[model samples]
Target: MKKQHIFQNALLTLLMLFGLAACQDREILTIENQSPAIVMDLSQEELFLDSNFPDNLALTIAWDVAKYSQPTELKYKVEASADESFEVPYVMGTVSGSQRVVSYTVGEMNKAAQTLGLTANEQGSLYFRVSSYIGEAGEYVTSTSNTTMLTITPYELEYPTFYLVGGATAAGWDAGQAIPLYKTSNMSYIYTYLTGNEPFRFLGQTNWNPLNYSIDQAGTRENYRYFKQVSSNLVQDGDENMKFTGTSGMYKISIDAATAVQSIEVEASPVAGWDFPEIYMVGSMNGWSATAPLTMAQVSPGIYEIVTPLGADAEFKFIGQKDWGDLEWGNILKDNHGYSGYVGPKGDNGNVKFVGNGGSYKVTVNLKAGTYTIVSQ
Candidate 1:
């Protein structure tokens, strides 16, 4: 009996020890090092416009609730003001939800401003601020993000309209002519235009700085100084009213015909007094080197012509240069007014015509058959 009692006490002690060990293991506490919470992210840090609101302006705001052990609901308030200090904000709106992402748009603001009888400011600035509040476990925490600034100004006006003149029945502007300008209350606006398949560079401007093409000389150039006019405004007015003409120059390009092409010709006039027109051919045939020096001979005065045998498939462009005193400049005069044509098999001849001179050579590439792409500079 004594031996049995000693064995039973040892087993009870072992069982108690095991239970204590299991309880200790269950008591272990795990602490999570939570990362910093992000409240919001503004799309742009600084937004500026010359006079009119940019047609393309969008802002995305993303936010999150405070990190906590329990579920939380986040509330957000967005406010905008004409002043950066935000002393007086126009309560734009408020949103509340579990959503982590939200977007605010200038288009919406514009509509609201219109209702308030406020014309889109030609030269106005605005700022935005967002504050977020999170309610967790009967407690509320709030966070705010840095303000973002937006500046608005009037639209700029100073682009000339490109017009098509003449050619064979196939001769017409293949590339769409007429670059429309955006309205600006001020004189400064971002200008962007597409350069057709042809390779071109900005020659000297007649009234603006020869090298930089700035309109500081608009007063002096009068009729020649092009102004930025909105597309809506330009369509109402004729191209002649713009007073801007395409640069006069000649371009030499090689056509990679899908099939055998015949009777390919390049034509252009001289810049009145300049002579010895140098034409550079750019395209896959010549590796699209705008600066690549190619030899061009004048078949006729002013009217520079060159003929080369093109394979079933080829692509190319020709650029003309003239010596103005000691400086070599683009043959803008000739290129602006010149036209190019090609005769494929079966009397299929199409002419590529000039569109505009937005400081870049623009041409319409009309093909009879097959496909071709602009190769290089």
Candidate 2:
């Protein structure tokens, strides 16, 4: 009787395992092979965001429920970009569940537009689309909606101000005449010029009442000093004075307020008395824009140098002045070394070609030798 009872128990367990397998097979067979198509209402008037409404207004976006044969937790996201191609769109908002709706405030819309490369205060058109995704990693599936149009104007954010002062600077001890630093894409400050023997510090304000920057060591360029506003009269110091120990030459000084870090690099200074006030590089990489050319540093009498990233098939020419004045420098002749192997202003004007795997390179141009070298890093 005990043996019969054991046999019954084994038979019951086998039936249960077979039932689970059947259910799994049914679920797999029900999964749809095709993705759902997003339904959008484009008949409504084009959406618009006012420049004055920085954060007051809200825009609602809705779509029809995506259909699926199998159960899935779908996540919907609204995206926008400057171009209709939606090559690199910015996610404005997201939603989940049957609601299928997302509301974006005026400020939020403006930020999205700006993130898509829209300029501030300028009216512009943008393309909007919705994307839905299910699962993660290996099993992930995605669907995109038809594009919609949006018009918006973004607002610019206030930028921080900085000035170079103290004895090491070109301005010397004159706080009122401290050298101003320019802003860059990374929100850091950059200034390239010749330096003297004295130590220097950066002031947050124009008058230097607070926010002074220095270095931990008197002579080192790295490990910068920072300060915090304690009170009306008190100030908290971070490090020592920032100074250059070696001989004076052209240098690029960059200060990052966000990370409280600083870097100093030796660069070529301007020729003592070159005819051209400024020299720049105009190339295919920069859209060949004569107005916004990359400036080169004059390290020696007739030699100019610039450290920048070069792309494959990059071609460039040197311009004597800001605008396309008459003077220009191009390739002299093809050399066995490689692209950009040799360059000069003589003979037929040819764009200097850069041939490499594409990376950061320090380019030095010597007009007298009619040659150029691309030092890949």
Candidate 3:
């Protein structure tokens, strides 16, 4: 009887151990609510964004923490949409673990609202939702918060920045020295000289790899006659660079990045006589006289350069002709506009005030960038 009793207790102990092991296994693998209940709250009812106070707090948003089946971290992504149903969503950013609040500056909200279909000066409803993921790109599991609505009135904002880089451009394949261009909405433009027979490409950033854009990637390129594809350099997904073949002058290159595939448009600029035969410097050096004016060398297209001497505070201007016949360049300084650098083609403009010691200076004028630089050796 004693032996039977001991065996019965041992059997009970074994069953208990097996049950505990099963419980631990369930704890390790179980995931609770793959789609958790979420609620989002907004700080303000409306946002009339101002350009003056761009950094001011435009809005604050908060959301409930997502519940995970296990003790796992949750990732959150902020998404905006014009439609409450979120048929289309624009991801503003991703918030990593435990950050339940997000603050938006006037500038940030303005850009988001405009991008989400809110027009300038007109108020419209914008929907915000937070998407929660168990881990890594929402690959495992995902849940979305209830949408929050806010009436937003966005102001017009200036800009995006793009760069020009390649063998065809003046920067010449140097990504660090890539020429910068400005973009307003969809169109980015720059007026620059292109070297013939050499291929050029646009860089989305100041880096060489990954984001470089060329003719083949730009898709339906317009004014392709101005560019000839480099057939010799072509391989499958290789260097599809485009060589400039247009008339030898400055050209306006524009890209519309908003397209399905970015589109390119090139055209001859209306700027005239920028690449003239004899550009002269007749300033304080020659008593501002037209006669015996120092001749500037045409270093490149639309670019004139001269190495000359001047006196301290000696002011002078560049005339298209020897006698200043309308086309001229001078100090383009004014009330919050124009460059501290040299500019031209202005009426009754101020003479370029020489700020440095009077010595031999290499003065370079780039009509492309609409500026000039005076460098002292």
Of candidate 2, the 10-residue stretch with the lowest lDDT total is 228-237
Candidate 2 stretches greater than 4 Å from native: 1-10, 20-51, 119-123, 135-139, 153-180, 183-189, 192-250, 253-377
- Model 3 TM-score? 0.50
What ranking emerges by TM-score with the best candidate at the front? Answer: 3, 2, 1
State which candidate, 1 or 3, has the greater lDDT: 3
What does the lDDT come to for candidate 1?
0.36
lDDT of each: 0.36, 0.60, 0.68
**Lowest lDDT 10-mer window, candidate 3?**
223-232
* Tens digit of per-residue lDDT, candidate 3, span 147-204: 8888888887564356777666767778998877645466565656665556676666
Give per-residue lDDT, candidate 3, residue 93.
82
**How close is every model to the real structure, measured as TM-score?**
0.25, 0.44, 0.50
Instruction: Report how far off residue 24 is in candidate 1 (Å).
Output: 30
Best of the candidates, TM-score: 3
Q: Between the candidate structures 1 and 2, which one is better when assessed by TM-score?
A: 2
Question: Could you tell which candidate, 1 or 3, scores higher by TM-score?
Answer: 3
lDDT of 1 by residue, 77-97 (tens): 766666668666566666777
